[model samples]
Target: MMSSVINALSVDIEDWFQVGAFESTLDRADWPSFEHRVERNTDAVLAMFDDAGAKGTFFTLAWVAERYPALIRRIVAAGHELASHGYDHQRVFTLSAEAFRADLRKSRRLLEDAGGVAVTGYRAPSFSIDQQTPWAHAVLAEEGYAYSSSVAPVRHDHYGWAGSPRFGWRPVDGSGLLELPVTTARLAGRTLAAGGGGFFRMLPYEFSRWAVRQVNAEGHPAVLYFHPWEIDPGQPRVPNAPLRSKVRHYANLSAMEGKLRRLLRDFRWGRVDALVEGMTA
Candidate 1:
């Protein structure tokens, strides 16, 4: 049976070449040279959501919005919440406090201008906000963001702020801004990632379904996310990239759409904004 609880679904609006995995190999200056596939993949995602009658959030990159203004408008028109995924998908810990704020401001202005909606939520690129970036939540609050989904509560070489609260909490003292960590489930004394990403693509669909059910049974909404590129197997291959990056990026592209459809039908999916409202209320 499908869970009655509404879990938060999110799509990180980015292209395949723009991923952190290809950063070292692909220069940001040459992003325009690559074939842009985000629009087609994102449109496919929107159609998937429409078919399932589900609503979710699109954490958009201002870089993409600048090039694809019509795509941003299409997302808004489909009733999905629009949020920021930073100006160009820079890791939060990589930038100084002032630079981070500037990135946030730039992203918000572009997204709002392109989509014609108030952008309140944010998801750090690559889930990069952690203890080292203590000023992150404060910066977010100062920038007028109401909430952020930037922390992943699992250990990983690339990014993860392990031991953080599994659900939402005010990361900064006295700030109303909420930091909603990606969903995680405890299994046999070990914490496992229940949220989406490479793990979702690499692992079996049944495991993800089980994880969501476990989290829902505990009475918390599971916050899951994936990139628009995850569903596009035909996306250009980056053969020169590291083997690990290649595996993570291309492991199960063919399976993602089917798994995602099952996930949507198995749970009541909604936008992150609604989940934030409930948590704050």
Candidate 2:
């Protein structure tokens, strides 16, 4: 396949149960016994990226950093970028500004200390920055984050900033923050194809390729993200999960890694920081 120059690639370093859709069914406290879950998931991703000679960002939760310090170090050691995915996987909008600030601070410290790199970027637990939660940007700026990939920009049943610009700085109204929304392909005055999470898992390979091409056609970077759990089909299933979420989380799990391999092979990928640096230069 031909290689296309793509802007940035990112990975969310959370396990299967920690996803936002499953939050009601699975609690953070229940993750301790299954803590090692991320090791295999992350390792598969790292190895895949390694084989494709691609380096990208890994946004990890502080809980993961504190529990698996070695994993964080290993990601850095392997020449990938590290960023914070918050302390717990709580949605930023769900927290008060104080709590959100605390989450960012705690996660920032843990990730920086463990990974031995400056954690300048953050992604909220889910894409929790919607119109109602504009304060999230202020708190993020206050916490010293350089940029965020937290707003999905599509109208999902759970989260979205539907009318937000797909790319560019929003001024955060007051916080002086920059929001780097996830990749979305607009259709008929609305966003239909969003490349991330289970959406990445659910879409066909050719469609994803088309979506990225669409984003690139606009002269902006396509910020693609996925959790490690998306590739791990063997993960223990959460009981009483809503049918839609379960399918979104677990559907076509075995094929995802291969699809990702095709993505890496087809695109020129780099860490988000590298893209930022490349832009400024």
Candidate 3:
């Protein structure tokens, strides 16, 4: 009944120019060179959802919030949920526990201060939760997050927990934090990207629609997510990025916004925390 009431869609609010995929060539310190940030792009995403009368979660980087307080306020003003996407865009698995703690503490503080709400959800940058960092859930619980959308069930070069369930569930480890893994489907004994991130951008619109349907049919809320850049095709490019990263970042660029618009219209979606609380309550 809870799943029937709403769709659980999320947007990772970051600039097209600020992704970690280009970290080697374009350091975060070099962010000053880019004229565009998440302001107008975030507004565009908000407007897209608004046009569909959709309310969803925004897992914003504290890095973005610190630079654009008014934009953070605007997201709240428009009736979306606020959640953390880390303080910097660093991958969680690579950070030691202490370092990760610092990142979360800082992000939680800034996100709550700017957003004017308790941020109960966290999605790691690049979906970087894996077996190597299963302890991150306990850390999240310690940080007061009630749920996480960090784990990607699909295998990828940078992130993914292969064979992890694709739907939301309370952790068997008793961390008291619900794990809402990004959408995935099993194919040939491996996890395939059912939706979200660059995969969501690259896949055919019909395939995404079908994937969500399959996940929902199994009685879990379809947790779809995307980045601001995925829709902002005109943003500056990182030409020095490795060829593979370049292809992933730039593929199907112009067509993404339309696919997202269709998704908002076709699905019954809502904020991530709202759906979780609604389901468990």
Q: Give the per-residue lDDT digits (tens) of candidate 3, residues 25-95.
A: 78777786777657888898989988999999999999899989899999999999999999878999889
Candidate 3 residue 224 Cα shift, in angstroms, is 0.9
TM-score of 2: 0.94
Residue-pair clashes, model 2: 0
Worst 10 residues of 2 by lDDT: 168-177
Clashing pairs in 2: none
Task: Rank the models by lDDT, top first.
Answer: 1, 3, 2
Write out the backbone clash pairs for model 3.
7-268, 7-269, 7-270
TM-score for each model: 0.99, 0.94, 0.95
lDDT of 1 by residue, 17-71 (tens): 9999988999999998999999999999999999999999999999999999999
Regions of candidate 1 where Cα sits further than 4 Å from its true position: none
Top candidate, metric lDDT = 1
Q: Highest TM-score: give the candidate number.
A: 1
What C-alpha lDDT do the candidate models reach, one value each? 0.92, 0.82, 0.84
Candidates by TM-score, descending order: 1, 3, 2
- Candidate 1 clashing pairs? none
Q: Residue 59: error of model 2 in Å?
A: 0.9
Root-mean-square deviation per candidate: 0.7, 1.8, 2.0
